[model samples]
Every structure is written in C-alpha cells, then in structure tokens.
Target: MSNDRFSMCLASDLFRVKKLKSVFVALILMFLILFLTFAVCWVGSNLVSKVEVSETPSIEGETAPTITQEEKDGLLAALDSVINDSLMGSGAICLMEFLVMIITCIFVGKDFSNGTMRILVSRGANRVHLFISKWLTMAILVVAYSLFALLVSGILYAFKNDGSFTGYDFGILMRCFSLQLLCNLASMTISLMIAFLCRSSGSALGVSIGLYIILSVALSIISTVVSLSGGNQDWMMFMPMQQMNVAASAGSYSTDQLCAVIIMPIVYIAIAFAVGVSTFVKRDIK
Candidate 1:
C-alpha cells in the first residue's frame, strides 16, 4: 500500500512480463503493421503512375492520351483521401486493440495457471498492487506500439508521396488517437476479467477469441435487418465494430454517435474493474 511497496511491486510485475516474452511478440507484430501500412501506401501512390504511364501516347502519334484530365484528377483525389485516412491510422492500427486484449488475457491467465500470482501474493505483494502493475505493463506496450505506428506511417506516407508532408498537425494527429488507446484499454479490461474468471490460459483464450466472433455476428444481423427493412442504420455506430472503426478513423459518425460509442468501452472497463479487480483481490490465489 505504501509508495515504496507499490513501486517495487510494479517493477517486479513488469519484469515478469518481459520474461513472458509478450513484448517480443508485440515488437514482431508492430513490424507486420508497418509492413501492411507500407504496402497500402505503395499501391496507392503507384496506381496513378501506372495509369499515367500506360496511357501516354507516343510523340510520333498525333492521337491524344486516353487518360482524361478528369480521370487523373479523380485518381489524385482518391490518393489524397487514402493518405488522410492513413494519417489517422485507418489500416495501421486496426488490429491494435484486439492485440492488447489478447496479450493481456494470456499473461493474466498464465499468472494464475502457473501459480505466479499465488507466489507473488505469498511474497507480500498486495493483490491490488499486482493488478494495477499488470494493467500498467500492458498499457505501456499498447501505447508504445500505437505511437510507433502513427509516427512511422506519417513518415512513410510522406516519403511515398515525394516528401510532401501531410498538412495534418502532428499534435492533432496524436490527440485524435486517444480514442484508439481508450478503446484498446477498455478491451484489455474486459479480457482481463475473462482471464481472471477462467484463471487458465486455454480457457481465457477460448472466451476472449469469441468476443470478436460474437460482435461480428451481432453486427451482421443488425446490418442485414436494417438493409432489408430500409431503416436508419446509424444505430450500428454504437456497436463494437463501428465503435472501433470510429476510434481508428476508418468510419464516420456524428458527434453524438461518437460520444455514445465511447461510452461502450468505458462501461466495459467499469464493469470489469468492479467484478474482476475485486474478485482478484479477495479470491484465494492459493
């Protein structure tokens, strides 16, 4: 409970996470995210070049090039849109929140399954401190990954576009990504609850992985019904997938809808804290 104790407990938890090699795996995944971002940027930038080159009429030929000025303008506009979306982390940070959940769940479940939590508690680490420390460790990983993805994508997109840096303010870009961190943390919180309840890595994985499947099925049903009935589909904005999209700037929603979607994650975090943290604090780790 004392500051000294808390600090020591946090340090130990972080060390354990390092030993788990979760951070190593996250580092590898970060490169995969970067690779995907690079591919998208490359393709977008080259599309215009390929079209323009292919349609160029020979100097000897008096015929005009087949590509019209309007068509060229359209391609440029699309490229600009892609660059803007990439700046906001559209394709880059899409799987980030899911990654947060998975890493947290597996580590938490392992701590329980292998008697690590019991050992730590037996050594006088307060359960609350342990919980807080573990959460912070996972938070650090996602925060680092998120920032790296944003920073790299910014430079990558700029480089691909001939060094014409985007007009976006760096500060605003970082600020906009707060929603992403929030969504990821909220997901991590729920996964934490599942891990605590199952107290076994295998079981936790089974339940945690089902999370997306359930959301996908629910969203699909809602979308199908709305399309069939021709009802307003703005309600989907509050669903998990749409909510994540809004966080990642891959979808559009009104200010009201954004506010509503944010509440879903916060609620998940609140419930998880109430149930998971409390149970972990008191449940017999022996």
Candidate 2:
C-alpha cells in the first residue's frame, strides 16, 4: 500500500473504533480516576494541615501565637509529604493501571471475537498496521489519562493547601505520571498479546487478571522475604511494582531502587511489545 492510502486506511479505522461506546466509556473511567486522585490529594493535604496545627507550639506569654518561618516550612513539608505519600506511594497508580489494562484487553479482544478483525483484514487492512495503530492509539489515550490525573491532583493539592505548589515536588508528580503511563502501556500490550493468543475476550481477561494477581502475590512474597533478611531489601527492588513504589516514595528509596524504577518498566514494555507484535503476526485472523 502507498503511504497515502495506508494513512487514509489507518485514519478510517481509528475513527470507526474511536466512535465506539467502549472508547467513550474508557475515557469516562479515566476521568473518574483522575477526579478520585484529586479528591484523595485534597483530603490528605487538609489532614496534614490539621495535624500540623495541632502540633504547633504556643508562645509562652503572648495570647496570639506566631509561627516562625521554619515552622511554616515544616508545615508545608508535612502537607506535601503526607499528600504525596497517600496518593502516589505504594504503587497505587500501578494497581489502577492494571484495571485499565483489563479494559484495554476487553476492547481489543471484542474486536477480534466480534469478527471486526477478520472484516478489517479482508478489506486489505494489514494486520501489522492495524495492531500498531491500535496500540499507538491506546498508548496515547493512556498517556493523556495519566497527565490529566496528575494535573488535576496537583491543582487540587495546590488549591486546598494555601494555593502553594512546590517546584521541587513537581518532579515526584511527573514521575508518578510516567510510572503510571509506562505501566499502563506495558499491561495494555500484554493484554493485546493475550487476546491474540486466546482469541476470546473472556479468556483474555481471565488470563490477564490471573497473571496480574499471581505476579502481585509472588512479588509480595519476594519483597517480604528480602525485608526479613538482614539486608536493606535490595533484592525486592527488582520487582516492577516494588520499583514503582520506590519511585513514589519521594525520599525513602536508595539510588539502586531509583535505578530499578527506571529500568523495570522499560524492560516490561519492550518485552510486551515484542510478544504482542510476534503473536499478532502469526495468529490466524479467521
């Protein structure tokens, strides 16, 4: 196919799928998650402020207590710390991304199960092109969702917490977004691959969810064992979810854990994409 024709074909397929109710439902869910994150941040920041106020020292003589600059700084730091810890820490977004992965699998698998894939392929829509286009579209959507979630959370945090935003802590927010995006992409690719492998939406969802639960359990066991050992739980850093937790911990993780945070997601994404492409290429459309 010529470049122009390929582009036209891709555009047509994208529009068709984009108009589907499932796509809109997915977007709505993404926004709902974003709103929930904002709500979590807002409540967490307020709680931190309350705790800070309760802990503030009263002046010895003056009826009106004056807080020092250092105290103010401490309060702000406490709020930021608590809010970040509650919303972004412990791989919370990673779990959310796993849910999104299941949604992506349903969408992809339904296309195949409902005979859309065969119809599209019969219309000279190259399988590789269709797969790549759909993957890219989903990745773009996931990235957008992550960004919206981050932005809304940040804005809500600032609004409810003295209208102050910390420049230094913005990096943590960005990292959370990046981690969620990468994790979503990795899981989406894996789900697509599974859908192709199983050829049944129900089977694909079951297998993907089952593997996710198994991996979570195995990783938790490994992390627990590593922590119980005499060491600093360095071995647990290799797990993807653990790495994401390290990324979200703000200052709790070591340099090695930080590096793992940067590496594991990339490895997962690469492997998922490779497997997805390979399986799609070999699978029988009919």
Candidate 3:
C-alpha cells in the first residue's frame, strides 16, 4: 500500500480502537500533575518560611559582612517560587514528559500483549508503515499532552500569582516553553523505543521510569564530580534534561548554549526513532 493510504487506514483503525480512551486518560493524568505541582509549591513555601538565615560571612577583602537584608530574607514567596522560571518553566514539561512516557508505553505495549501486531501483520500491512503510523500518532499525542500541561500550568500560575504578567519577559518565557515542548518530544521518543523493545506494559513501565530516574541521577553525579574537579565540560550541555532545566532557569546562558539545547533534543529523538524502527522491523511479534 502507498504510505499515505496506509497511514490513513491505520489512523482510522487507531481511532476505532483506544484513541479517545487514551486521550481521556491523558487529560486525567495532566490534572493530577497540576495538583501535584500546586502541592509541591505550597509545601516548599512552607518549608522555606521556617528557615532562619543568621550567618554573616566575611569576605577576603571586606572588613564587614556583605550580607544585605533582602539577601537575608532567604527565600522568595510561595507564589513567586511557583511562577518563577524554575518551576513553571520546566516543571510543566517534566510532568508532561512523565505522563507521555507512561501513556505511550502502555498504549503501544498493549498491542503486543493483545496480539494486535500479529493481527495487523496478518492483514498484510507493511511492518514499516505500521510502525511509522503508530509511532507518529503517539508523537502527536505527546505534543497534545505537553501543550495541555503548559496551558494548565500557566493558568494555575497566573491564578496563584494574582494574574500578573508585569515584568515578565515574554521572549524568554516563550523560548523556555518551546524548549520544554521539544525536550518532552525527545523524551517521548525515547519512551517509544523502550516500549517497543520491552513489548510488555509492565516491563516497559518499570524500565522506562527506572532508566529515566537513574540516568538523571547519574548525570547529576557526573556534573557534581566535574564541578568539584574544577573542569568545565561544555559537552554536558548536550544532555536533554540538563538543557531543559537550563532553559527553564532565568540565568544568562549564552545564545549558542540555547541553540545547542534545540539541536541536542532533535539529535536524541532521531537516534531513538531510528533504533525503535530497526527493532520493530527485525523483532518477531509473539
């Protein structure tokens, strides 16, 4: 069959199967994430309020302590922290990535469990076409879920922060949001690869979550080690999660650094998709 025809047919089949159900599930998960974000912000704010900063450190060249009252105030307000670049910027994206990974893993793995792949192959659908259509559909769903996350998070932030956009840098905010979406797309593609390889929702869920958490911790350790050694590893910027967090921060990262953030995720996504396609083409459906 022609690629277009195959895609349309598969899309129709997908729609008839679990498309709406998957979307509904994603919506429910997004709301849950929204609530979690609120709770985290509230708890963090309360924790920050209990902290007292009484230390006055002396500088090498200064006779008196350099501490200022504003600096001694310790932490920003709860609302400020929630609406700040750190949480709202990449937090929504992080939550979206988590939801997309779980949703896509289960959605694709179910085909293997229910013998859907065998049925599709028996119907004479090209393996490559089937793979592309399903993968593309899941990618689209990831984008949808990520956007929903961005919207809901933005609304909550504005509501809690008294609907203030004043002094906010629109250019930076938009850039961060765009980076979040791209990073989530990269993460989703990786999850797709994991789901395809595992071929079972239970295995896929465990592997995907564990790998994500472990790799994040490993990278952080590597970063800390490098920092302690006083070695500047510019290549660390290529890490997708790092790039996402850096972009989410209000710090002054170079333009080249920001550009790298955009390029690295695409490279990761391409590699992941290629691997998934290869595995799907070669592996037999049991």
Top candidate, metric lDDT:
1
> In candidate 1, what are the lDDT values of residues 38-148, reduced to their tens digit?
676568757665654434434656564456556767776776666666556665565666666778888888888888888878888878777777777877877887888
Candidate 2, 1-286: lDDT as tens digits: 5566567656765676567676566666655654565566556646545543325566689665556556766766775655565456332355456656666677677778888878878887777787777677667656765666566567755765578878855776777667556656766777767777777778988998888778889887876786787556775656655543443563565677667766776787788777777887887786
Off by over 4 Å in 1: 40-44, 52-87, 166-172
Model 3: weakest 10-residue lDDT segment is 63-72
Can you give the lDDT of residue 159 in candidate 2?
A: 68
Highest TM-score: give the candidate number.
1
TM-score, candidate number 2: 0.76
Cα lDDT of model 3 by residue, 3-104, tens digit? 776877578546844554756776786677566767666666655555554356545786544544455354445345564643455555666677778877
* Per-model CA lDDT versus the true structure: 0.73, 0.66, 0.71
Runs in model 2 lying further than 4 Å from the true structure: 20-82, 86-92, 243-247
